[model samples]
Target chain A: MNIGSLLGAIGQGFIWGIMTLGIYITYKILNVSDLTVDGSFATGGAVFAVTALSNIHPTICLFIAMFVGGICGLVTGILHTKFKIPAILAGILTQLGLYSVNLRILGDKANISVAPVSTNITFLANVLNIPHTRAGMLLGIIISIMCILLLYFLLGTEFGASIRATGNNEKMIRALGVNTDNIKLFGIILSNMLIGLSGALLVQMNKYADVGMGKGAIVYGLASIVIGEVFFRRFSNFGIKLMSSVFGCIVFFIIRAFVISLGLKANDMQLLSATIVVIALAMPIFKENINIRKVGKINSLNEMKQVSSSDEIVKEKIEKREVTEVGGGNNA
Target chain B: MLKLKNIYKTFNSGTINEKRALDDINLVLNDGDFVTVIGGNGAGKSTLQNVISGTIMPDFGTVEINGINITKYPEHKRAKYIGRVFQDPMLGTASDMWIEENLALAIKRGENRSAFKWMIDNNNSLFFKEQVAKLGLGLEDRLKTKVKLLSGGQRQAITLLMSTLKKPDLLMLDEHTAALDPKTASLVLNLTDEIVKTSNITTLMITHNMRDALNYGNRLIMMDQGRIIFDVAGDEKKKLTVEDLLQKFNTTKDAPSDAMILG
Candidate 1:
């Protein structure tokens, strides 16, 4: 990719990478495949557009967008945790419902361009008076670093620990006297809040928000997470994992930019992203199945040793019985 | 400190698979009462613990802990008063969390957990290392290691430590050592006894092993078909022999096949 295009791709990646952090909470930590991002992303953009049209501060609009997105997640969380709905279906339902909600926020219009811009165009450009192209790159880096730091600290706190524990073992957390439903609700809320903030940033960068802005957003998020995990699989520290996930986002966007330059059509983008996510998701399961084909897929050497020792004991007993019994050779 | 009054529960009610899991069960545990429960598969031993822990609510009964009606409370709410370890080592502790982190979570049992304070504070971490050191499994030095990397015995020990950290009003162990090897199982059972003795926590343990049932607790209870068939304690329980228990177990034709093999 050309230098300018590559920088632009990185900028776009940083915005989506913020959303990827949200997905990390639901997908990796909370262990819930929240499909709400497809809708929550648009909800964020819609809220930002509506609030900005009313002459609100851009930063305030970002908070409003996140608040709206968090509500969407709260709906999904309640449905899954309390109303007895399956998690995926609950997220799907919220996502589907947000279609009309997003439309309403957009004043029943499909698109709202930030023309004759109400406030200075980009966050970095407005605040730092930097060139537009450089501002884009700078904005991405700043937001990403901010999110990584916040998440690292949050996940270290008691509430965050319980939330992670809730994702890790629901029964264990509940046994430890944590009201797990509340913890899950908070996790979903926090995750979608970041996703909404990312959406707001995307709208500012593109200078327009569309009703279909969130289409395939979940695929991208998952792709970013998978890519990040593939590269940082060995880093167990929470901050490193978050930073790598954002790094994954930047790489994913840059690669997409390069492929587009190679004549990939806009209509084909969704299909390509979907395929990438499917492959990433299936790789681990495929590995397990391959292992299962080999002697019951013993996970560790300790188990293998146990199995072999049991076999040796049986062999020794048969030999001992042969020596003690007459005509044992005929029986064998 | 714990009471189950006429607890009745049924699964798949009105269906061909309908079976009564708890049949008007009544139980009372005094503070520091360490009771061992023995039963065959599907004998409702697990169902009893589940009811107490609020994982399963009795269809028609009241559960009271320390004079409060807890039958209507949710499972998480009841956790404030109850500690539990499952047969599967994975169930009692978060595998992804560190060994010390697991204990940190445990120490907060029955307390507000939504605070924003640092989870692994120096005070808590030091306390965890010291408490784990007492297990004598060399886990004290590996506080940062994830619980998943530990052996089954180690995981069970950590889980046990977690359950008893703050001394729950009642501790329930549902075949906690059944998944471990014989030697490991014995080791965990011994550790369990030590913890119970030192903490003086009220405990209810269900074991498929009849010998363990008779040997570990201050009281022993036998169950068949969702009913407490025999209860013994103190001098009377001490005089009982394994052969007598096995003979008694075999008299019931539907007794667990494995119970007959008990020594």
Candidate 2:
């Protein structure tokens, strides 16, 4: 790939990498398929774009977008935990609701493009004396790296262990005196906050936010997690998993770029992403079956050992009997 | 002490499949009381334990632990005062977690703080090792091993240790040894008896083995349908035999199911 193309792909990958962290929290840590990601992404973009357009500081706008996204996640958590709705359906319901909320945040427009010179990227580029695209790329990398570090620290905290425990075994955690419902709410909110931040960053990078930007976002996140786990098998630690997810997102984008270079159509990208996720999830199951077959072979070996040992004992007993019979005959 | 007064629990309350799981259950357990519960299938043994542990809300009743009415407390809330062991070895502890990690969580049960850091003090580890060492299963040296690698009986033994570590006011055992082989089951049972006697904690255990019911506890309770049909304690419980239990089972209006009898 050309240098410019490579930089562009890497920049986009960084943004998705942050989003993948959010996805990892919900999908891997909480073990919940949170479909609210799509709408929450748009929600972040819309909130950030509108707020920034109104002369708010970009940082403030970013925080606002994250807060909005967290609220969306909270709603999903409440619906699932309190109302007893299925988790997947709860996510779908929230995603659908956010569609209209996002539109309202964007003044009913499907797209919001900031003035070219006044856009967040241009403002940063002018301040730093760099090209807007390069500035955007640098900004994406910094934000993604910061997110990964913060998440890594959080997951190591006592509350984080409880959250991980909640996903790993809710019953055990509950029996340990943790109110897992609260933990679920906390996890979902945190996940969507990261997702929203990713959207906010994406809009600044592209100089515009569109309602359709979040489509297939969940699939992208899942694909990144799967790819990261596959690539980084030795890092089973929680921190490593977080970092791998970020790397997975970056790798995914680079792969996409390569696919484009190979003359693949843009329409086929989603198809390829879905296929990758399916294959990645099936890897462990496939590995397990192979391991089971190996175990069967080892078990047969153990059986043989037992058989030989028993035969030796029997032979020893028979020899003793022969000795006793010879002694009795000699005495006679 | 723990008390249950006139507790009633019915499943599928208005439908044709409605079944009474617990009926007018009344019992009083003093401090350090170790009681073994025995019944055929659907005899409300587990249901009674669930009710006391706050896993299920009784349709009508009162439960008091140490003179505190906990009838309305949620399951997680009641966990502070009650420790439980399930029949499935995998249910009581996280299989993927290290043995010490699981113990750490249990040790901190009912504490308000989170247990994120693995920087357990040497003193704490020494204490834990002492507790685990009591099982005589060599688990003190295997504290870092993931619990999933342990055998069912070993896991159950570890779970028993973990549960008694906190010395909750009431300990509930729900057929905890039913899943093991005979040898392993006896091993776990021996550990259970030792832990209960040494801790002097009030405990209620459910077991399908009639002999185990007669042998383990100072008191033995037999349930039929949703209510206790017989409760024998002290010297009388020690003198009871499997034949005596079989006679008691026959006299109850609700016949014991085949699974309960065979089990």
Best by TM-score: 1
Q: Give the per-residue lDDT of model 2 (tens digit) for A147-179.
A: 887877776555666777788888877877889
**TM-score of A-chain in each prediction?**
0.85, 0.84
Q: Which clashing pairs does model 2 show?
A: A158-B116
For residue A179, give model 2's deviation from the true position in Å: 1.8
Runs in model 1 deviating more than 4 A are A120-123, A285-332, B250-253
TM-score of chain B of 2: 0.96
In candidate 2 chain B, what residue range of length 10 has the lowest lDDT sum?
A: B112-121
Worst 10 residues of 2 chain A by lDDT: A323-332
Model 1, range A128-219, lDDT digits (tens) per residue? 88767668667767877998998888888877889899999998998888888888888888899999988888888888999999999998
Listed models, DockQ each: 0.47, 0.31
Interface root-mean-square deviation of model 2 in angstroms is 8.2
Global lDDT of each model? 0.85, 0.85
Error of 1 at A275 (Å): 2.3
- Cα displacement (angstroms), candidate 2, residue B191, comes to 1.4
